[model samples]
Target: MATFAPANVLDFGGAQLIYELASAIFPAVKKMKGDYSLGQVAKLYYSFIWITSPLMFWGAYLEIRRQSDSILTKCKEKKIFFVLFFLIFSPLCTFILLNFSFESKNVDDIRVYLSFHSRLGMPVWGGIVPTSASVMAAMTAFGIRYFCCVFD
Candidate 1:
């Protein structure tokens, strides 16, 4: 019989790993994505999936690859494997996005968030955010993203 770690152990480990990744990435992410948009949400999700999750499997994948005789040949095989995986992965991602998107498809569904962003009105937490501060935040976010994209 095979033994396994407790489910809570695995869950807590995964959550800690994700939290660390978020903490490390938060500076750049905060710079690139300040507002609540689809782009910001996508960046956050993909960064967690691609950058963080890979480390969990990287050692196992490398061990599997090393089963092959030649180093160069094994790397080539691994690359091809991931490429094919991504070919399937991307479409599945799109399908999930499409289905979830259609479920709450209306722009109005997110209108409350958008309206909160407006500089004009909206009492939040018993006080309205000043228009000048909102405008400044938007402009700063735009300028930061622009410079980072253009230079980096």
Candidate 2:
């Protein structure tokens, strides 16, 4: 049987790896911006999204599976709280996804967006939200699993 400690450690390590991968990709993305046409940019964006989706889903699945029993027990104990929390957070997750999709545009527009990330005149929230959302999702999953393990 797999140990929980190793699983938890791997989860965190995977998250950090993903973070570093994203950071590395940002520079390449910035370079590619304005070089490609609209259709090309759209293709690239969707390609990245498609590639990452399976990985993210697998990570989430692993997290949930790790704490399945505990989460079930917790839901049994605090069903209402779980439901309410899910209700409130679901919209936030949706908003994040919408923002991610909305940001995907023509290469020219993409260049402007990339320029914003270069520590220049950028809207604070613009640069922060995407990165923050990713970190938050990973952290949230880790936290919930930890909490479930501790409580149950």
Candidate 3:
């Protein structure tokens, strides 16, 4: 869950980190006439977010259920939180992707889409980065407690 924020920023915030990583993996992307543009990066980011959003909920459910003795009890307790998490980000990302104009294949032509998505995606997801940090801290503590049985 905490990962959502960073992933969001890397994908939509015009950081080009993802592009750099991709270039490293696929050397052709860095070649003379390779199709390595912000537009291609945006497409990759969009696909990544769409695929991973639902998986976050599943992973959360599995983690929550693993920690709890009773499956039904934990599901009942965390159901609303998980649902709300899915509801909020899914539509926002979808709306941003839908509204972002991806008409052209050229990097220059897709600046509009890049700018629009970045403008909206950055602040919105950036505000949640602190929350994600807190979550990571809490999850780390929970993991330590669970594994070591020191806090049980």
Question: Which pairs clash in the backbone of model 3?
Answer: none
Tens digit per residue, CA lDDT, model 3, 50-107: 3343455456545754765553344346655433443444344434433332334554
Model 1 lowest lDDT segment of ten: 121-130
- lDDT minimum window of 10 residues, candidate 2: 1-10
Ranking by lDDT: 2, 3, 1
- Candidates 2 and 3, the one with greater lDDT: 2
Q: What is the lDDT of residue 67 in candidate 3?
A: 63
lDDT of 1 by residue, 61-109 (tens): 4443454235335334465543333334434543443233212224465
TM-score of each candidate structure, all chains considered together:
0.24, 0.38, 0.26
Cα lDDT of model 2 by residue, 82-125, tens digit: 54443346446735643444344443574445433322322332
After superposing candidate 1 on the true structure, give the runs of residues whose Cα lies further than 4 Å from its correct spot. 1-21, 25-31, 50-53, 56-64, 72-152
Report lDDT (CA) for all predictions: 0.34, 0.44, 0.40
By lDDT, the best candidate is 2
